[model samples]
Target: MVFIRWFLGKCILLINALTLPKPMLRIKADQDKVDKKTQFFTLYQFEACPFCVKVRRFIRKNSLKIDLKDAKNNMANKSELVNNGGKHKVPCLKIEKLNEKTMWLYESDAIIAFLAKETELS
Candidate 1:
C-alpha cells in the first residue's frame, strides 16, 4: 500500500512538471491606445511562475514604472484578476484606461510586445 501510494504521488508530480499549463492571453492594448500620463501598469504574479518572470524582466529592462502584486498572497487582487480575466494566472497586465477602469491581459509574448511598443523600449 505504501509503495503504491508513493508511486501515485510520484506520478502526480511528474505529470505536473511535464504538463505545466500554458498561460492565457486576452485583450491586446497598443501603445497609442494607452495614455502616457498613466502612473504605472499593474502586474499580478507569483515568484516561481516563469511567465511572470518574462514580463517583469521586460518591464525592468525598459524601465517601466508599474505596480507589482503577488498573486499568491493578495486575495483581493487575486480575486479581482480571476473575476475579470476568468483565470488565476500570473504575468497578467493591468492597464489603467483613460476612464479609470483597469484592464486585465495575459500571455507572456503579447504582454512583452505591448509593453515594448507602448514604452518605446523595444
Candidate 2:
C-alpha cells in the first residue's frame, strides 16, 4: 500500500511537471508596481503539495515576486507558520502592510484570487 501510494504520488508529480503553465507577459512598469505591492508578501508551502503547486503556478504565471518559505524541511519556517499564522498549513500567504498590519491567508484558491486582484490593479 505504501508503494502504491508513493507510485501514485510520483505519477501526479510527473503530470504536474509535464503540464506546467507559462508565465504571463511582464511589462516593466507593471512589474515594478507588482514588486512594490508584493514586497511584504511571503508564501509558506511544501514542495510536493498539490495546493502549493497550484499557488506556485499562479505566482509564476502572473510573474509575482513573492518569497517562498519551505515549511516541510525548515524547522524555523514550520514554527513561524504555527506561531504567526496560527496554523501549520501549506500555501498560506503572509502579507505585511506598510502600516505594520499583518495577515495570514490560507487556502490555495483564495490566494490565487487575491494575487489576481492585486496584479490587475498594477
Candidate 3:
C-alpha cells in the first residue's frame, strides 16, 4: 500500500510538471505589490499531495509568489505544522498579518480562496 501510494504520488507530480499552467500576466508594479504582500504568507505542503498540487497550480496560474515549506521532509517545518498549526496536514497556509495574530489555515479550497481574495488574482 505504501509503495502504491508513492508510485501514484510520483505519477501525479510528473503529470503536473508536464502540463504546467500559464501564469496570469501582470504589470511589473502590480506584480511587485503582490509579491510584497505575499511575503508574510507561507504554504506548508507535501510535494506529492494532490490537494497541495491543486493549491500550487492556483498559485502558479495566478502568479503568486508565496513561499513553500516542505512539511513532509523538513523536520523543522513538520514540527511547526504539527505544533503551531495543531495538525499534521498538507496544504496548510501560515498567515502572518501585520499587527494581527498569526493564523494557520487548512484545506486546499480554503487556502486557494483566501489567496485569491488576498492577492485579488481570481
Query: What is the lDDT for 26 in model 1?
Result: 23
**For residues 1-122, what per-residue lDDT tens digits would candidate 3 score against the true structure?**
99999999999999999999999999998999899889999999999999999999999999999999999999999999999999999899999999999999999999999998889743
> Per-residue lDDT for 62-110 in model 2, tens only?
8889999999799999999999899998899999998777999999999
Judged by lDDT relative to the true structure, which candidate is superior, 1 or 2?
2
> Local error of candidate 1 at 90, Å?
1.5
Question: Please, what are the lDDT tens digits per residue for candidate 1 over residues 1-122?
Answer: 97886676566556555755553232345333332533667888875466776676666555556788888778998898898877998788888867676778889898887776666522
Best by TM-score: 3
Q: Give the Cα error of residue 42 in candidate 1, in Å.
A: 0.6
What ranking of all candidate models by lDDT puts the best one first? 3, 2, 1
> Model 1, clash count?
0
Weakest lDDT window of 10 consecutive positions for candidate 3: 113-122
For model 2 the TM-score comes to 0.90
> What CA RMSD would you report for each candidate?
9.9, 1.7, 1.4
